[model samples]
Structure formats: structure tokens, C-alpha cells
Target: MADNADRAGEIIENRLEGMLGAIALPPRTFAEPICVDCDGEIPAARRQAAPWCVTCAPCQSIRERGSRR
Candidate 1:
């Protein structure tokens, strides 16, 4: 039973590696983050979490909510 589980794990790992290799991930780009709407300083945490962010978290949330219409 243990041997079977080990083999299954190996198969899954190999498949995952192949899948990852098949995709071409985009290169990350960093921008100077500033809240366009509020002209407030965007936190480093938010910028690191979303490198392409143009606004602070609160502004972004509001923008997303407004777009749901």
C-alpha cells in the first residue's frame, strides 16, 4: 500500500512539473504605485502583493464594486 502511494505521488509530481514547464509565464514588472483617484501613497504591502496596482486597496475595492454593474 505504501509503495503504491509513493508511486502515485511521484506520478502527480511529474505531471505537475510538465504542466508548469508547458506554460510561458510573463515577466514581472514593477511600477511606481500611487492612488490615482485619491492621490494617496500606496502601501508597500499592497504594491508588493499587486505589482501592477495603480491605486490603494480601498480605492481599488471601490472601483471593483462600481464595475460590477
Candidate 2:
């Protein structure tokens, strides 16, 4: 039934939210001056805009692609 399906969906969504909340999130290190990936010096403007960037743009893109697997 549609009502049953809706309820099931809500339950699944809540469970997923709880699981995500339980996982430890990486600490915010955007205020750090160095890139964790390539050791490139992060520009002040970029750091201000994205306070949690750990890699330069190119390195970050590569890391993202790898994580998709």
C-alpha cells in the first residue's frame, strides 16, 4: 500500500540519518595553511572561502574521483 511504502521510506531515511550522525566526521582543518595532499601553500582567499579544503583543486578532484569507487 502507498501508506505502508511511505512509512517504510521514512523509517529507512531516519535510520540512515542516525547512522550518519553516529559516524565520526573529519575535523575541520581549513584554517591550516598547508594542503594535506600536495603540500602546496593554500592561498588565503581560498582558505577563507572553503575552510575545510585539505587539497589543492586538482588534487581534490582526483581524490574525489577515487572515492566514488
Candidate 3:
């Protein structure tokens, strides 16, 4: 049988999980130097500017434009 402490812990854990799910976090893995879509090398300047970036400027621009539709 579950005790009161266990029930409280489960409630807290559930709430925490819900809160974490609502947050938008960056990927935990390292970003590759190459763009995933165009197979072009991501610029060193861009990489330095945005370490979490996964696409080059052109590919990213296209993706953004497509997303607006």
C-alpha cells in the first residue's frame, strides 16, 4: 500500500513533469558543424553566434518561410 509520503512525492513528480513539458529547451546533444538539410558546412561565425543552430542561413530562411504558410 502507498503511504502519504509516497502519494505526495508522486503528486510533486507529476507536477514537475508537467511544468518541464511546457518549457521549450534546446537540444541536449551537440550541434553538428554541417547543415542537416542542404549538406553544406555551417559557417564558423554562425556556429559561434548560435551554438544551438542546426541549419545554415539559407536553409533556415526557407524553413521559416515555409512555416509561415
TM-score list, all predictions: 0.57, 0.50, 0.56
Q: What tens digits encode model 3's per-residue C-alpha lDDT throughout 1-69?
A: 999999999999999999999999775555688999999999888887787999999999999999999
Best candidate according to lDDT? 3
lDDT of candidates 1 onward, in order: 0.84, 0.81, 0.90
lDDT of 2 at 33: 77
**Whose lDDT is higher: candidate 1's or candidate 2's?**
1
Better of 1 and 2 by TM-score: 1
Better structure of 2 and 3 per lDDT: 3
Each candidate: RMSD: 3.7, 5.1, 6.6
Judge candidate 1 against the unseen true structure and give its global Cα lDDT, from 0 to 1: 0.84
**Candidate 1: worst 10 consecutive residues by lDDT?**
25-34
- Residue lDDT tens for model 2, 1-69: 579889999999999999999998656555677888889887888777787776777788999999999
User: Residue 61 CA error for candidate 1 (Å)?
Assistant: 0.7
lDDT of 1 by residue, 1-69 (tens): 579889999999999999999997644665466788899989988777777788988998999999998
Q: How many clashes in each candidate?
A: 0, 1, 0
